[model samples]
Target: MPVPADQAHPLTADVAIVGGGIIGLATAWRLTRAGLSAIVIDPSPGSGASLSAAGMIAPVSEMSYQHGRLFALMRDSAAEYPTFVAALEADAQTDVGYRETETLVCAADPADRQMLADLQHYQQAAGGEVEALTSRAARRLEPALSPSLSGAFHSAGDHQVNPRRITAALQTVLPAIIRRTAVELIETESSSGTAVTGVRLDDGRTITAPVTVLATGMTPTRAPLPDDVPLPLRPIRGEVLRTRLPSGLPPLLEHTIRGIVTGRPIYLVPRADGEIVIGATSREDNREGPSVEGVSQLLRDAQRLVPGIGECELTEVTARARPGTHDDAPYLGTVGTAGRGPISGLIVANGFYRHGILLTPLASRLAAQLVLRELDPPTVPESTDHPATADTDHHHLQTMNPRRIAHPAAENQPQGGRP
Candidate 1:
């Protein structure tokens, strides 16, 4: 709900997060858990790219040759998911629909099989536990799979979560949320330099805080920031479909199916509630709405993998944009000036194209630490026993620096980014 305008003119908190998607809400939740007051501002919370995601935490299946840092980040985030969801559910008293099901990567034809083979070799070399499976062996594990599959691989480490459930859970535990658009950032000049005090909402209200976080996924919310603060982000739109199986029919799939059919990649994620999510068509034409051609292509490719999909009811079609960068990696750090180190109270946590859901737990924790200026912590092993140390966080932030426009491997890759 929108905060009533007459109630207050200037809201104050320890941190003001601009954008109420998974990143923003989860960051606020983390801040509150750390004994800090934080408020989230957005026009509609949880209705952006987070809602359109299939929520696959598939670090292995989605691995790319050029994105080694991203792969490590994804792997680490997925490992922390159990602890994150447990804490969130305990606080919210609701399930976030997290599933630990394995994923099956399939190939439609001979050419697709060759491509799958190449990916398997790379996955093995990168320390990903993947097994190349024969078509018969793959069908045995997933009986509903089409017998026409030429090749497949088993990724037992891959899993998924319900993005909507996650956002709802975070919303329940957060302290404050103003349902309004943040139109601009409020800056204050001090002896040190210019620092972000808070944000100016569209309703003529202001939110004042020492720290401000920009987690606005794919929304161009960075327009309010200074021109020198680098945020080279672009929108890559995707279309997804939802369907329900017939009442009498059994579940269509036991595991998530990710496949390539004639060079077009697609995935079908099955839920316990008899719902299957089929997607997605990645494009850059800037069509903000669902396209007929994209829908047709998804259904066709999904049917090629699971023929039973044709019998399901077409429940819904959705289109949303995922924030893309030149290297297809996220921009997660403080806003830096040309000569200055970092702005006093400005942090950026955006450009998470396809891995937003997978990266939520770590991203939120890192953002909260940045807000409290608690970047340094005692050194500890990589486990749930203790939070990540400054060494780990700094390494991640450096890899995702907003000012670094080009990646070392970006120009060498044929796609020029993550495929």
Candidate 2:
């Protein structure tokens, strides 16, 4: 007899991913390819931060003075994106809108030129390629740039992707079971709290798994979990606006344009479809209604960078919350101390901040390596134990015989029984 839609059989898999964002879906897809049965749970899988992101794969452009480890990680991830997206597209038989263009950092005022110079110096010191140009030369590359533009630096390695297209493609191609429901994870034993034995749904039904990954973005911050396994994450809200330009709008911007004003960064991303994205204002923990002030602030800054934007059509406006972590880097790898006893099967792939889309490929590979324990070529930082200290010395990498956790098989098992 077929199970009714209202009362379907409890689904079981080798792994269960709690979040359906890019990281979660990527992890699930990798697990499935590795011969592990996997499932992803989320109400809106791709519409979170991934959808709202500008998708800039910029390790050099976005680098700051602090956190060298995070920079190395971003660089490694950016390097892996091209091949990763290729394989993913081949698997899905679809296009992901991967754009391989350079990014330009510009300064609209003379005082801001020093900032661009400082950034160029830092890039050179880090052994990255950057080209410094005067206002005229900068305008030569992007004619739409204002005549008063002081200076610009170009990072040729930086690129972008259409986050919406990638997300939609993944959701369509991934083989894992995807459900639209809220999942609550519960620890079977107090001592092994990090080991998620199973998850309970709203209707009082339970599904168990040997491995459960928490990629629920900020939602897990509100969930009940052991103190040791709690996520030290917060939400940073950002507002963005999109505009449609008339035909032959000068192709004013070739690569992504980022400008610094009042010590804060604002950016304008030009799409192949004549849509320019001008964004964004960062606010701390405030999800209040959108403000005209916020939109005006972005427009003021954008118009300062390129006066032509004043005439563009305001197509859309939206706001989203980005997950931030205590370490300022994403929280990856296994949670809790290993070898204490029965290890908790919970793995964290969250706290990606603004780099989620850019880092998806590397994050997916790392998560898959951790789960499968298999060594494969082109895998950066062979050892997953010391993720923060992984060597970025080599441009290419691989991993070796990872340990695999054994799980109870569901063959001839009763429905609703604990694993």
Candidate 3:
């Protein structure tokens, strides 16, 4: 039995993960599967930035210029997703809404078409599997698309999974979770050095562990850390909307529709149950709720790509902030010194930004390897086809090192801003 939140009893585990978003929960799941006891600490799981995400696993359509390392990590994660979701579903006895449907990148105007042509060229040069398509071919795949589209392209490898279902499955399979907020880190100092021993909850209970993973997203209530550990995380708010087609109607789209309408990007992700997820507008503000302007712009841009979007009923409007980093890449490595020496027992997995859902598999697997000190973890049954490549790329890990922005000597490293 679990101890009550009001009780002052302390718990022990192999790993104590802060934050219960998909990333946190999935990492915990990975650790538990590796024969280590782990616990997730959160006030409410799956109610943060992960809740509002459109869950696009399209590394091709989502690619940008000069983010080669990040793109490689994304592609590896997308490849491993099938194995990840299959094992999770079998273990939890629930579907995670994984779909292999292709993605269509549409251009709604002449300017948008030109921009897409350039992006496609960049994507092709980067070894991405994308094919140019005429507007007629795109409409044949997704008839709901507006006929006024100037051009389109096919990203056959890009796919998606429902974030809500994935989070719920992780919650089900993970054996331990503390339903409380982590207020602070419990550090222990010894002759060796200062190491994080565990975490202190808001209810005054401490969960002791040898390793503590800080997978906290963009929540304002995150625990305070020491001055030396520089996270440099910022919040990038996004607005997303969910809509349902009227009864007796088919899904408005088969493949996900990612489009640039009047130079602004929008996407429509249609679910099997006739629900289409549309979004989003990126803003660098501190607003806590959906804004009128953001919603109006999303609706307008989305309707321009798929004319049928205007007839759907809006079900939910979500506004949440994603944790972004200086280089737009996730901070995956452990916090360390100038020589990349890791601080004992402290591992960070944050600043995933917009790719949180898509990056979960690779992030979770890598975190588990770090915690267990395993160099060659066995691939899950279905993941054999796509071996774990990103975790082994030394250069990629260096670029994603959390200390890059913190260390004075490492400050000269190249920085890539958000696209």
lDDT by candidate, in order shown: 0.82, 0.69, 0.82
For residues 215-260, could you state the per-residue lDDT of candidate 3 as single tens digits?
Answer: 9988878876666677888889989999998999777789999999
Residue-level lDDT of model 1, residues 150-226, one tens digit each, is 98999999999999999988988876788778888888877777788888887777888878889998774532777
Cα lDDT, model 1, residue 136: 97
TM-score for each prediction? Answer: 0.92, 0.84, 0.92
lDDT of 2 by residue, 118-186 (tens): 877877787678888887887888888888887888888988887877877777766554455545676
| Candidate 3 overall lDDT versus native | 0.82
Q: Per-residue lDDT for 171 in model 1?
A: 84
- TM-score of model number 1: 0.92
Worst 10 residues of 2 by lDDT: 398-407
Q: Write the number of the candidate with greater lDDT, choosing between 1 and 2.
A: 1
Clashing pairs in 1: none
Clashes of each: 0, 4, 0
Q: What lDDT would candidate 1 get against the real structure?
A: 0.82
